[model samples]
Target: MFQLLIVDDEASVVDSLADTLPWHEIGISTVFKAYSGSEALELLKTNTIDIMMTDIRMPGLNGLELLALVRREWKRIKCILLSGHAEFSYAQQAIQHDAHEYLLKPISDGEVLDKVGNLVGILQRERDESRHYERVEKAFQEHLPKLQGDLLADLLQGVKISPERLGQKLESLKIAIPAEGRFALMLFRLEDRFAELDFYSLSLMEYAVVNMAEELFEDDFRLWSCKDLHGYLVFLVTIAGEGDTQQDRQEHPDRAAEPVESRLQSMASQLQLSVDRFLKGSVSVLISRWGSFPLDIKRLYEDILLSMRKQVGNQSGLLIYASDELEQLPVHALQRLYEPPMLVHLLESGDWEKTHDKLTGIWSELGAKWADSQEHLLEAFFSIYASFSSFAHKNGRQLTDMIGPHLSDVTGLTPSRSLEALQQWMFQSLELLQQCMENETRNDRENTVRRIKLFVQKHLVEDVSLQAIADYMYMHPVHVSRIFKLETGENLSDFVLRLKMEQAAFLLADPSLKNYEVALQLGYQNPNYFIKVFKKYYSLTPQEFRQKLEAVEEQ
Candidate 1:
């Protein structure tokens, strides 16, 4: 409920207003009366006054003076001025003092009530907006972990953020990890035992796992944990040593190493034990070698992801430390095949010769250095096979369908154990891809043309933009337009216009419709443009076409 104060030098005016105004109807429960401005000031000190209505000419403390004092003391109190004189200076003073209303002395109760009602609305709105802000702040606090998790996930997925900008973000999000501190990343993968659970239950289990991790490492390190892009639980861990700054710790590596590594290993074991005991799930922890923050994070993530790939289905419940001697793969070795316009993209676009040449470049580079190593050979094989499988699957075919009986020999590590066998398998797979692209390209072009025609027919009276059609087919418009022209021997734009004109001709056969009405029916807004287009297509305007049709029907 809101409270109001009525102040005047004349006690009758104050008393009349206090007793007669409909305070409760406009959400005001109590009205206080004061005979002078000083009395009003005293009332303001004790009461939560929402509004104050006062006579301007009070003797001891005038209304404008009282309002100025109130503005200093209680800024929230909305003031209204009442006076016998209609002086320009008085109204100006009232407005300057931020009074809500200025009325001459003989104001009606309705006028006073209306002004107060508006002020009450302002107060209520302020309260509502304030409450909404508070609720939003509370929600942000509750979901801060998830937000931080998403940010960490993006970072691990190789999304770049500058160090200064990243530090600002960390400060704003209240994350405690230092921007340049040395840290380790760990990947946690849940075993088959917990895989059958629903997503929500699995999420709860993951949250519990993070909480257990926080508890385990809270004493020795700062942990920023999140689910990485590939659904692995990833943690960026920094040591929490006392009395030493990050620079100091970096300078004194000998003192920090033994204790920190031992603590991390111990904590990993405890985390696994806790999950096994409480959640009946086993997780493998793959820990990366220590690296500096922000810059090294993406590279570290890639290294750990490769490590995790090696232990799939064989190393559950194990804590594997990434090898310090492991060399970082050169950018061209893996990045070319994984990035855009890579082998898969070229194959999808039926660029057979380019796809073959790209693979040859990758193989030539790898064979130069790592040809004899079995592990390196397997990595190369899997990389090529995975990209091929992904492309084949996208084109509604399987890798087995392309490679046929040779799939088993290529996939088996024993047969492709030698570098020569691996090379042969790689080239053999490329040969098969080229052949499949040859046949699939023909079928795919036909299917694309059919789908485009169907889409055009379906959207004849609506927007049939080339980009929209390309989006529906999930290909670039320029590419689709080229393919359409190759397959249909006509440009896509010409096809659409022809179809629309044919539809317009069919609609023109109806005798009851007007020319403008038929243009609108064909999705054209300007009748003149529509008529010109109709003449260009059929050698007759819409009116001439309709008249010709009527003459034929009568004959």
Candidate 2:
């Protein structure tokens, strides 16, 4: 639908065009009559007029002048020039001003309708095209991140793609880095400070870390990063240009220029300091040697992973350079123990089955590869123990309380004495931990339901929305609703409504209270809506119900 304004020096002409024409049938929802060009401008300022019909002979802002002004300010509004004169000069001026139509006075209504309807069709087509473009742009923006992340992840995992295909993927994902460019890989592992956070909080902190990295590295490098399979943030960075000087060098020109490796190490240290200061979290960074893209990406990733495990094991806030010479190790590091969906995350999320599978994978890897090595055995032992201890402490329990005497002899290394002994202790401890967690979860659910009910009762006369209740309980609204329904077999919304109606019924028992007063006391500002809801529940209006109660008492 559209709105229109009819302007002329004579009021009769304006009223005739507004009233006599079939504007509504041509999709014009509103028609305003203006006696002069100035009046039409005022209406256009206050309203969204889609089509303007004005007389060319009006005094002060003639039709051609008004057309120029409208074209400048509101270019989308279609203008029609109506004049009594049939002179070619007026029509030529109207055409110069980009008027949509030039019609003579005493024109038939059918001709006017035909011209306006054509303009409306054009507007409709333009609107449809604009909306389609907006939707496409929105969808592209929504999926752009995932598309970039997926291609990078596949490349890191050594997914083979021809050079042509990789270039096409890069161009389509709008990645600025060339497929043939040299790049360095940086692996970042969040430390114990972030381990206590839940999955959602952890994801947010990881996003913060990436955003901070982008801000710090953007001037010197083009950075692309993704969360890898092993729960580490992997960054692919390439120097933007040789001309870009480091901030410190720009500040202190006399200082000797540093190599790219030293520059990266300094930047990584700055990132760690920024995260520690701003987000109150520690990050361990491993910087890889620069390598050619596509060909050396997978190897660089593997090298960095090895460097991280061997050089930065069980440590926090450490920055290691993979290119630096370090002592070579004879034994292979256990892969499954630190692989994706690691033991600690599984335990924190209370995924017992996955945790068991992870443990099994670790034990199998140890037996098949390093069975005779006591150091590998101890590595497995300490890793599992750390995960278990972290989970227990997060839940306000001690490791000894959950595993009993098995953990009591940590000094003797009793659990790591043998493969069979470690397996026995590991499974037993897992079973005991699972039982304790399951029992606690059940009790927690009951306690949550009780608290939700108590909160609803206390704030019954205030805002009792799900968001309000969730804020009070310090939980996600969806989680609160799910737990409430799971424990009570009733929807939280239905529970709130039922309690409100019940309280309304009790309040109505007082003969001296007005119906609106009772409604106000129960948080219902609209007495009529309250009466409708009360009638729906009780099969009678509040007034009728109150009268019935009085009748019953008199009887």
Please count the clashing residue pairs in each candidate, in the order shown: 0, 0
**Candidate 2 structure quality by residue, lDDT tens digits, 1-555:** 998888886644664566556788999998876665665676677679898988888888888888888998988899999989999999898888889899998887798899899989988988878776887788988998777878888888766588898888888788877656789999999987798999999999998998999999886677898988889999998986644468856764533455677778888999999999999989999988888887888778988988887889997899988953332556466767876677899999888998999899888988888888899899999999888899999989998887786554588898898888888888888999999889989999999999999999999888786657877999866678789999999988779879988998898998789999998998877786677677867889999998898899999
Q: Listing every candidate in turn, what is its Cα RMSD in Å to the true structure after a full C-alpha superposition?
A: 21.7, 18.5
* Colliding pairs, model 1: none
Give Cα distance to truth, residue 60, candidate 1, Å. 60
In candidate 2, where is summed lDDT lowest over 10 consecutive residues? 323-332
Q: How many backbone clashes does candidate 1 have?
A: 0
Q: Quick one: how many clashes does candidate 2 have?
A: 0
User: lDDT of each prediction vs. the true structure?
Assistant: 0.80, 0.84
Model 2 regions lying over 4 Å from their true place: 1-330, 458-486, 505-526, 543-555
lDDT of 1 by residue, 276-373 (tens): 99999899998898998877887788778777777554667888887643364452245434534566677778777778777776677666776666
Using Cα atoms with residue i matched to residue i, what is each candidate's TM-score against the true structure?
Answer: 0.41, 0.45
Give me the candidate number with maximum lDDT.
2
